[model samples]
Structure formats: C-alpha cells, structure tokens
Target: MPVDKTSYLLVDGENIDATLGNSILGRRPHPDERPRWDRLLAFTQERWAQPAKGLFFLNASTGLPMAFVQALRALGYVPVPLSGSAEDKVVDIAIQRTLEALGERDDDVMLVSHDGDFLEAITPLMDGQRRVGLIAFEEFRNSGFHDLVRQGMEFFDLEHDTRVFNAPLPRLRIIPIEEFDPQQFL
Candidate 1:
C-alpha cells in the first residue's frame, strides 16, 4: 500500500461522535464541543501522503446542527445525511454502496467507524487491488470486526492520536466552600 495513493475516507458520523465524545473524551454524547476537523484532516493527509476525500455520513433525524455541518464543509468534507428512523440503515447502506463504487477505482479506501456492520463492505474491498483500511477507536480492539486486523486491514486508533481528534475539554474552576456566600444564590 503506497502512501501516495489517494484515499477516500467514509465516516459514520454518529457512531464516531458517540465513541469519541462519550467513551474517549468523557463528555456527553453530541455535546456542543466537537473534534477539531481541520486538524484531523491535515493529520490524515500528512500521514497518508495524499489528500483524502472525506465523506461524512450523519443521521438527519438527529437534528444535525447547521453550524456543525458548515464546519464540516469548511474543513473539506462532504456531509451525507441519512434519515433518522429506527429501522433506517441508510448510513450503513450508503457507506457500503460508496465502498463498492470506489473499490473499482485505483485509489485507496478507508472506513472511519467502529460499527461492525461495515465488515460486509470492508471484506470484499480487502480482496481487491486497492489498499483498504479502517480508522477507529482503540476500544474496538475487542469489537466483532477485530478479525479484520488479522485479515490485513490497517487499523489506526484515534485514541492514540488525540492531538488531532480531541475536542477541547471544559475547564474546571475551584472555589473554597467557606468563601462561598449563601447570599450569592439570591
């Protein structure tokens, strides 16, 4: 796998946000704070040695904030919104379809997600000529798709690379209880 080849990065936004925000960052899911997209894009481009074309798949029913969507676009990602129905598997389906379409191309393919549902799409891509890999959290080492690693899928753990992906943690301010005035409540 030559690093010079272009890589198409397909991201499952909701799945990643949950893992990064709650599991890694110790923040509530979908908190106002967000990962630094610009830094992440730059890091990936530098590490891979070619500009990665980013496609971010999110659920529309989750009420994606416009500011976030704008931010994604500003950072050079195409936002693909899927319906937010309980039975909706649009995001997974879209990711699979895109992978299949790009598998025929010469560029590399990277799936940025921890969901094992993507294994179906990832398996065939691995057998193809183009290089295929996965970017996920370290927690997924125990996930169902862990076998993909043994099958030669390149896995990049975002947890180990927090400089690029972490959202800013909220600062805590400390005050002496004795100095606190009950009148302040009024």
Candidate 2:
C-alpha cells in the first residue's frame, strides 16, 4: 500500500534521538540531528500524496526546556508536551492519547520511535481500520514491532534511508540548553 497523504506522523522526541544516535555504550553520539529531520521530511514528501502534519511528543518533566520545543515549533512540528513521574512513560501515554484522537476520526498515525511499548497501543488502531508506521534505527528494532512494521507500517533506518543523505553533524544536539541557537553556539 502507498503512503497515506492524510496520515499523521507522530514522533517520540526522546525515542527518535535515542534510536538515531543511541549506542550500546549509552548516549554515544550522532553528530548532526538536522539530517535526520531532513531525511524524515524528504521521506514524507516522496511517500505521502499530501503534506503531512508532524506531531512531536515530548516530556515536560524531563526538563526538555521550552526553547527547544519552540525551535521544533519553528521547524513546523506540533509539540505535545507531557508531564508525569517518568517522561518516557508519559510520552507513551501521550502517544496513545493522540492515537485515540486520531482513532475517533479513523485517521492514520505514524510513529517515529523504536519503543516497543507502542506496539500494543497501535495494534488497536490498525485493527480498527487505521494505518501507522514506525521510523527507527536497526539496533533498537524489536522483533515484536516487525509485525507492525510489515503490516503497512513503514520503517526507515537512518543509515539506509536516502533522505537522511550523507550530511553528518560536527556534534550531537541531544541535550537541552538555554536559548539554543545552533548558529550562535555551533
């Protein structure tokens, strides 16, 4: 099946960074994160028949900072802030909640994260006649998620995805800082 133009791409902010730059050594490095975003947009351009809306789910309690979220908003992504004891858990719930929102309208949902916990929440959407995809890295890829990936759920690896291109960053911008301006700092 071709990519749905009306599909919504819901991103797990932390999951995306982790899967994109994560390593066995923990918090390794990926250099540049822009290429990842570029590739993601390019993929959507080629795959979707219409412009898709990007929703980034972030954890507020994790101290993600407002400036970064504003930057993401500036980049044209809708920021859905989550607050709770655990940011990750909250993000998971937020994803499900957003999924439910889409469910009400029978709209397709695409998740760009390697979190396996979403498999259960997304299955219901799929079973209910909705579409979803997972854009993630190979290292964190779980077999359980493969079924979802195979069932019209698109999965793109940064290493293999042509949209990500060959551009690598001088450093990873995973950490949040006050008034982050890449041009001024980097």
- Identify the leading candidate in terms of lDDT: 1
> What's the TM-score of every candidate structure?
0.75, 0.73
* Cα lDDT tens digits for candidate 1, 1-186: 643568788888777777666765587655445566666666577767787888988777767678878989998998887775788788888898898787677788777788888777778788756667777766643376678777877777654453554554432323369767778458
**Runs in model 1 with CA error above 4 Å?**
1-5, 21-33, 62-64, 166-186
lDDT minimum window of 10 residues, candidate 1: 166-175
lDDT of 2 by residue, 1-186 (tens): 753446687888777666555443256544453345545655764675557678888888857678877877777678888788842488888887787777666566667777777777777777646556667665566677878767766666644453563654343434447646779557
Cα deviation of 1 in candidate 2 (Å)?
21
Model 2 spans > 4 angstroms off: 1-5, 24-35, 62-64, 127-130, 165-186
True-vs-predicted CA distance for residue 24, candidate 1, Å:
4.1
Quality of model 2 by C-alpha lDDT: 0.67
* TM-score result, candidate 2: 0.73
Q: lDDT scores for all predictions?
A: 0.72, 0.67
Cα deviation at 69, candidate 2, in Å, is: 1.5
